[model samples]
Target: MQLGTFSFVTKLAGFEYTKFVRYDDEGDLRVIKAENAGPHGFKTTNYSRVRSSSVAELTRSRLHGGELLMVFVGAGTGNVATVPEGKDFFLGPNIGMMRVETDTVSPRFVELFLRSSVGKALATAAMKAVAQPSLSMGTIRQIPVLLPPAEEQQEILRLVEQALTAAAECGADVREQQSSADILRQSILAAAFRGELA
Candidate 1:
């Protein structure tokens, strides 16, 4: 199913409509703006919250888990993310959210697809701009989604995540090994210069 076939909404721009409030102490509403959602993905630790004070804000701007977030405008034109679990965030400017309404469509799969090279290419092709690049809600709603069955989607997501984790671990190991090798080389040079190689 197309992503927006479920439900979609852009972040509101009513400054006056929002009450200046922070969840830093009370922990109610958290705002995930475009800046918080980078091209890499959404980070759980950025800790930026909404500008709304009244609980009525939840009636519209509330973001549930498992929605695919996309950077619809500006420099981050193609950035996408699956909202992490444990907390819900309020969507902010230059961002779009597609909350999957059916068990048939996997949100994780959609997020990964949008981040893939093919998906990025499609988004770039649809992009239009004068000063800043942007993808209209229509463009996103019509995105050609590859729907494997739910089980296949889960398996693919699991395997891809595992592979990515292994790759990251290998990279860290390589960096650590290289750093030790550099130190050893420097030590060998210092010993030779001091005629301690004997």
Candidate 2:
């Protein structure tokens, strides 16, 4: 079955920020926008909040957790993230949320594919070539997905996780090296000021 075939996939409707959005410091529902969804994952620390009352009107936008979020509009278009379970997040403008109803197809697997080079190319090709490139829900549904065996899919996910963990560690190492270099430069500057270098 294709993505939009309702039998296996459920596409959540996104609400326009200007029309239904009312940011409240006390709001319990956080809006996950394009910026919130990135390569690494959804950034939970900082995001706009909408009143629960406003969200009650648009129940479809409320994330049920495990939904694959895709940014469909603007420069950050095609960015994807998996909504963490137990988080109260609402779909913001320029983004779309999709939920896989069947346990046979893992949402994470779909997310990984969507972030892959092949998936990105497919999405890019499907996008409307306007000044602001965008992918409609219809276009998204039309995009083909290859289904590997369940065991194979699991193996692929495990490998991706391992690679991501290594990448994160490497990033940390780079940052540490940069910090050490900065400290060494400062120490050298301080020694020069004190006339320690003969």
RMSD of each: 3.1, 2.5
Q: Model-by-model lDDT, in order?
A: 0.74, 0.77
Among these predictions, the greatest TM-score belongs to 2
Per-residue alpha-carbon lDDT of candidate 1 for residues 1-198, written as tens digits (9 for 90 to 100): 555675564554557235533445455667777765676677666666553454444455677777778888888887988787877677666777777778777777887877889877876677885689988888888777777888999999999899889999999999999999999999999999999998
TM for every model, in the order presented, reads 0.80, 0.88
Error of 1 at 19 (Å): 7.7
Best-fitting candidate, scored by lDDT: 2
Candidate 1 weakest ten by summed lDDT: 16-25
Clashing pairs in 1: none
Show where candidate 1 strays beyond 4 Å: 7-9, 13-27, 185-198
